[model samples]
Target chain A: MLDRIRIVLIGTSHPGNIGAAARAMKTMGLSQLAVVAPRCDPRDGEAFARSSGAEDILEAMQQFETLEAAVTDCTLVVGASARSRTLPWPLCSPRELSASLPGELSGSDTGLALVFGREDVGLSNSELQRCHRHVHIPTSEHYSSLNLAAAVQVLAYECRQAWLTTTPVTSPEPFGVEWDNPLASHADTERLFEHLERTLINIGFHDPDNPRQLMARLRRLLLRSRMDSMELNILRGILTRIERHGDPNGNDHPR
Target chain B: MLDRIRIVLIGTSHPGNIGAAARAMKTMGLSQLAVVAPRCDPRDGEAFARSSGAEDILEAMQQFETLEAAVTDCTLVVGASARSRTLPWPLCSPRELSASLPGELSGSDTGLALVFGREDVGLSNSELQRCHRHVHIPTSEHYSSLNLAAAVQVLAYECRQAWLTTTPVTSPEPFGVEWDNPLASHADTERLFEHLERTLINIGFHDPDNPRQLMARLRRLLLRSRMDSMELNILRGILTRIERHGDPNGNDHPR
Candidate 1:
């Protein structure tokens, strides 16, 4: 899913940010890079210097004269902007953007583009309007601006998380006995509770009309225990025997 | 919960970083600041100049003779370091560190302390040992080093998020059903579950020999729904009547 997504740098001024962006994309298992009119040479000494070992992405980078040319093949375009734009076109949080990408690009041959603007000016209104969605990087209210590379890193991290979560992962097996299939049945357990309630009523342990806290506490205790079928049956048996012995009249206990 | 977070800087050399740390903390709604063995006076012009209106944090900062003195009152001590240590003592991711704070400090007067080291060299081995846990922020492998102020900002942001999550705020009253006062008690629900299991057995819905997935699914469903006392009673009442009618023979029903 990540491979199908192409990250486009639109009018990027800093060679270091372009390099860093490549590194970020590579870390998150994304490689397709399209540079739209980069001011600095992406393959220059400074660009590769900042790119670290992600020079491969810079080497394979495709240059485009215009943003439209860069994103023409793309089906879903995500524009990265620190500040909100005047025109709205499906504004999404980073989390939502990450989540929506996989489904939108699954099995589709069409490319998905993530466009990042220059550090100083950012994406113009016309530039932002070309994209399907706008993603904002949450920052401190005092200083909402983020370093260009840092923004790329945050977005890349989120994308990786989305990919990992969607993929299957093994988990440890659960402990404890199977509850659904024990010696006792649902019928037996219900009878046991009825008998217990009756016994409580008989012993003046409960006042049904204006019951206080005892029952609630008792319920919490039982829930915490996570009783299995066999165990419940055993308890029920005891209750039934006790009820039979205590009630000779066989009259149903009143609430 | 935000008030309970104590930010401690040990042997800090840069006065600017100290001021910046104060600003970061204030931005995240964290007020407590402690300085231990600072190379420069925290109240110096350089420190105050960079504080950026967070002078109150510097003014209220406590000076400690030793790291031990600073963390003496704290129950949960988190040490921040960029590099891994020789002997790892329960290393925690930033998110884990954030999540663990609330539970560790709940109802306790003891504050949660986050210890940061100098800008040049992080916490010493002995100083790191004083912390109950160590947390490392995820950074690029090429340049994992983060500016001291930047590190503080990231940590403070995470801490603020954790604190807000733990601290319950007033919410709008739930609409529709009185979930808090469900007709059934917890005890009643447990009984219903038991009875339902028995019914399932009789109906061949549950196989005794091999039953794990189904039971787990059922339990998960009930747990997610958050069954209440009143709801439990209503269900139990229905189950009791069904058991009595379905299996009239007392001997056949057993317990």
Candidate 2:
């Protein structure tokens, strides 16, 4: 799903930002980058310097003289906007754009282009009109403009996050992740609670007649803790120890 | 709510990255900036130049000697981690951290600190342990380390997105939530851990000599639970009772 989405930079002025943008995209697992009518050479020294370890992405970048040529193969073109209220095109947040990607580019061959405008002026009215939709990153009203590379980072991050939901990396296991022992079952938890309540009363820490939400609060905490079988056994062992210590007989038989 | 969130950079080596981070935060409506023992002067020319128009945030940046000092007042401290599977700390996604902000910072006095470590080395194990939770930004497994500014941009952007869409919940209080008590502060939680360690040792449930990841497992469980002050107090009371009852004299003492 991430591979189907290409990052398109339109009329990008700074060569360094282009490299930085590539680095940003690569960090989020994006490979395809397209430049439309860049003002400067995209492969300048500063571009390589800013590309960090992502020089391969910069080397493979596709360049075109016009937006039409750049995204001619794309089935969905969403222009990145600065949240302009006057635009007639349907505007979506970066999250919304990410959410719509799996469906919009459902086919393996279908390509989607996310077009970012120049740092100073952004996309021209004609360029904006050509997009299928506009995706806007919400920014502070006081300082609305975001650096080109930073904007790309946010969008690419969102796309990666959304894409992760579509694929099954590892089957979702019960919580208590990587525990050596199995997570305590519901019945085990209930039995532990009963034993805990009895021990608490035996130790005079809890009063049954006026419980006053003590057991309820303990239940809430322990349930949220999500203990595994080992941790549960440890707690139960501790409770038994306290019960024996408090008992006058110090025997197996309960009073 | 955004105002309560502070971005703390630890041992940052570059002035330019500092400036870029400020710009990233300000673009997302986050103004608070704190630095722990930065390697370079944060107010250098490169920092100011890279800050773009977010110079005010850079100008007002707070300097600290250590991570503890940087986040002393914050009730919640979340670290940006590179998704190391061996870590015992509770790990959350950026969106999960953002979604939790409203509920975690429900009180007016509550504050949150998002800590980013040294650009090259990332957070030390000790520094990572200080955080109540660790937030990992999903990136390509091949090139997981994000540029410090890019990581800040991604996290800050999610915070802004979550803030914009948040509506106060009119629904009844959810289970495990205590309305009256604020979430336990970092200091409070630390004290609880100290007390817990001592109590476990006193009860012979744990041995300090051969500590086999016992405390780490317990820490992971309790931190995931996210105890409020009242619940924390209740647990402390229970510990004190057990300690006293186990003593032969039933004296007012920890031992």
Candidate 3:
């Protein structure tokens, strides 16, 4: 899904930004780069310096005279806009774009274009109209101006996350991750809760008669935490110490 | 949550990157920064210039001689990495990191450290082991190198998003932040599972030959939610009760 996606930079004012954007794309598992009517040379010294060893991406980047020509093969063109216009486009957050990307990338020949405009001014009204959707990165109202490269990084990162969900990687396990250790089983968790209830009662910390919201809050806390085996052991060790010595700070002297 | 998160850069080579990182942090509403034995002076002209009007953060930055000194008050230390080392730490993507961050932050006094290593070598093995968790920003296998400022920006953005959750969030959750609680450390969670599988097999609930989907489902359930210390104690107590009684339904009776 990531491979089918193309990153388009339209009339970028600075070559350094192009390089930085390329670097950002590479860091987020993106390679296909296209430049439509770029103002500066992407292979210049500033670009090379800014790329930080992602010259390969800049070298292989496709250059076209027009945005339409660049995204001619793309079925879905998502323009990145910094502002809301008089006529609103299908604007959503970067995360929303990621969620809907898989469905759009389903077609074999379907290409998805993530078009970024010039550093000074974003996509033109006509340019944005040619696109299928628009994504706005939420920032503080005080300083909402995000750097072109930073914006690219955010969007690229989102695409990679979304791609991980859609396609299974050949190298790593599903979602490119599989835990080396197992999580605490449901049965064990239930037992831990009982042990906790007992320990609390013994230590005069909790009253079973008027349990109140203690157990519920604890359940919410533990259930949310998803304790692993070792954490359970550590907590159990502490609890056992408390039960034996009735000392809350008996954690330092372990058996 | 964002205020409690400290961005620690250890032995950074470039002063400019530090300034840029500070800029990124300021943009994302993060201020706490700790530099452990940096190669270049953060107060240098380059750092100030790179900060881009975020000199207040740079001016208020904390300096330390060692990683230990920097994170003395922190309970949960998470390292960011770009490479896969011989010793694989508890690795997760940035999105996952952001989701689990809020619960950990609920303990008002507990501090969480987001440690970034040297530009070239990253966090050392010992440094990583000292850390409770690790996060890897998913990058392209071909060119996975990430700029220090860019890396900081991504994490700061995530932390800002996570922080938004604990406080009354002004904006809707991007990617739907379903945080129940903070996750247990890898070591602790492992012990709970080992103890669980042993007890279940002992009590005739599981056969080692045909483990079935019981454990898998349990894992999904546990990992889906976060658990806290008291919750772990409660669950462990219940497990102990079952171990003693050799009865899956012996949860009601006290030991």
**Number of the predicted model whose lDDT against the real structure is largest:** 2
> For each candidate, what's the DockQ?
0.05, 0.51, 0.19
Interface RMSD of each: 14.5, 2.9, 9.2
Q: Give the candidates in order of DockQ, highest first.
A: 2, 3, 1
Which docking band does candidate 1 fall into?
incorrect
Q: Let me know the DockQ for model 3.
A: 0.19
lDDT of 2 by residue, A15-133 (tens): 99998999999999999999998999999999999999899899889999899998988999999989574747898988888888778878867999999999999998999999999
Residues A1-255 of candidate 3 have per-residue lDDT tens digits of 888889999999888889999899988888899999989887788987898888888999999999999999999899998888999778888878889988988888999999998878889999999988888876655555577888899889889889888766555422234544456788888888888778777655578899887888777666655566655654565456446443324443232
lDDT of 2 at B221: 70
- Write the residue-wise lDDT of candidate 1 on A122-239 in tens digits: 8888888888889876555655445565566657656755676687845311211122433345566556567767755543345688677656555553443444565565455534
What lDDT tens digits, residue by residue, belong to model 2 across residues B1-255? 899999999999999999999999999999999999999999999999999999999999999999878887788888998857464556778987787777666676689999999988999977887777788888898887589999999999988877897788442222324466677877778889899989888866789999886777777677767677899999899888888877767864323
lDDT for residue B115 in candidate 1, whole number 0-100 = 94
Error of 2 at A5 (Å): 2.3
> TM-scores, in order shown?
0.50, 0.87, 0.68
Error of 1 at A12 (Å): 3.1
TM-score top scorer: 2
Best by DockQ: 2
Better-scoring candidate (DockQ), 1 or 3: 3
